[model samples]
Target: MPPIDTSIKEHLNALLDRGKGAGAAKAPAASPVSTALQRDGASVDFENVIAEMLGAIQDMETQLSSVLEINTLLETDLNQAKERIRELRQEREKLLSTIARLEEEMPSKRELQMVIDQLIEERSDAEITIRDLRRRDEQVGAVLKGLQDAQRALEDSRAQLQSELAAVEVRLEAALKDCGKLETRNRALEEKNAANAAAIKELEADLRMALDERFRLSIELDETRRALAAMQGR
Candidate 1:
């Protein structure tokens, strides 16, 4: 932000003081500001006020820019998490397929009894392999469940971020609109002040003419009185 020009404030104050001084020196006349300069703070430093507002808006935008960058990173993370979930789901499907194939190839109870009698050791090995497959399937199921829960959490976080971003955008828009309105109001005040200045000049001129006329009338009255007193003495 640029430094505020204190000179403008000083100039405006000087003008107001001068106007007051001029009014006090002359006969009482209607004030132009009381009637014509209706806007608030006709003598206030509006430029400085506007500059401050702009600076605040710039700050807000900068902060929002940072927030946007953070949101982008979070979105990237969300995407990565989704991809991981997809891969896990694919693995789970493959595991299920393997389990289905193994079940289809397994022997019936009567065949198992016959195989047990012919190869008891091989049956024990088959049992152990089947138990391991079941345990692996359970592990895959647990992993998939955990991934689903994490996905839900990420989605919730993303939704919150989106809501906050939307609100910030709304506030930024409102601030900009307010800035435009202040500019319009400042322009209107400048025009009003200009018109008031012209009117004051004309009023001052009329006052000077009136003062001159009064002075002339007073001199003539004194001369008439002197002439009458001289005639009365004769």
Candidate 2:
């Protein structure tokens, strides 16, 4: 297609050139009304062409302004999109760093579960140990009670023995007092028997002296009787 300006100029030059050619070919006896009509037709054609050209130019200017506005809006949207993508990239990097740091600080799932299981087992063992210790404490308490009972029994028996020993000692003291009295009585009887034996020895000596005296007296008496009887017979 031709340029709007160029087409308008070409159309106008063609009408002018046709007018010149018509004037040269026509006789000078052309009517004034027909000439006036020709000039009016030429002017109308020029005005129509000019109006079409102006309308086309105005339409082009309006289309160019719309395109510029659309381009400006598109550029603004593109720039905003680019800035948003950059922010997203930075956020993604920060999230990746956070994930890496957390991974280093925390344990793996399997290892953490194993540690928890071990802790549970340890708690179970501690509970069992506490139960065993409580049982042992009860046994020790029973043994201590038994020992206390034995001690009380031994103390009672000792008290009983002490009472029996006191009674025996009292009986021995009484018997010892009786033995002392018997020894004193036996000594007095022995002294009395000694005095009686001395008296019996003196009596025996006096009886022997008397018997000899009697015998001497009897002999003398018999001699006298014999003398007297002899005298009488003489």
Candidate 3:
């Protein structure tokens, strides 16, 4: 037995011995007076002796009852101790199983942590690339806007030039029509001048003929007058 159990047993035995000693000490004490009363054939004063015997019996009974009560309490305590030991052993086994499981999973937990870190790094790099692409897209949009503005300006210039060209074409057409009218008028005037020149030449020839006739008549008149004067003188 364990030392504690041995000690408890020793204590119980001591209690039993103490109870026995108390009982033995309280045994009936016989008196010589009572024995003489019995031998003289007279009635012994038995009341005092009887009272002493009854007291001794009651004392012994009290001691025995005390010992029995102590034994019962010790047994109850021992049973409770045994139940506590059994529960402690079960709890120890459960703790050992949990520790073993944790040990088995340590390497996998480390690997998972490494994978998470790598994924985080990759995500950071991707975010940087996305930012760069957005900047480039903004630059391209600015360039496209500039090109659209230039195209609009060029179209406006072309429209203005076309309007001016249409006005110039209308003016040229009108000038060409006026030139044709002037040419026709000049040709008609040239023909009329030629006809007037022919008419003037015919009138000059008739006037010269008439002047020759007048000159002949005047010479005849002068001859007649000279003949008459010769006659009168004869």
Number of backbone-clashing residue pairs for each candidate, in the order shown: 0, 0, 0
Local distance difference test scores for all models: 0.51, 0.51, 0.49
lDDT of 3 by residue, 1-234 (tens): 011134433543454465467567864443454355448764322233333433443454454455455546555655655555555455555555554554463344356457556655555555658876566556555654665565566556556555555555565565455555545554554454444344434433443343354345445534644565566578
lDDT of 2 by residue, 52-160 (tens): 4445444544554554555565556556555555554555555556545544654455764575566555555556578765665565556556655655665565566
Report the poorest 10 consecutive residues by lDDT, candidate 2. Answer: 42-51
- State candidate 3's TM-score: 0.35
The residue-by-residue lDDT of candidate 1 on 1-234, one tens digit each, is: 122245643544454465567556965333443334335433333334434444544454454455455556555655655555555455555555654554565445576456435444444445557876566556555655665565566556556655655655565565555555545554554555455445444544443454465457557646755776687689
Rank candidates, TM-score, best first: 1, 3, 2
Residue 56 miss distance in model 2 (angstroms): 1.1
- In model 3, state the lDDT of residue 115: 52
Clashing pairs in 1: none
Candidate 1 is scored at a TM of 0.37
Consecutive 10-residue window with the lowest summed lDDT within model 3: 1-10
C-alpha RMSD values across all candidates: 19.2, 97.5, 92.6
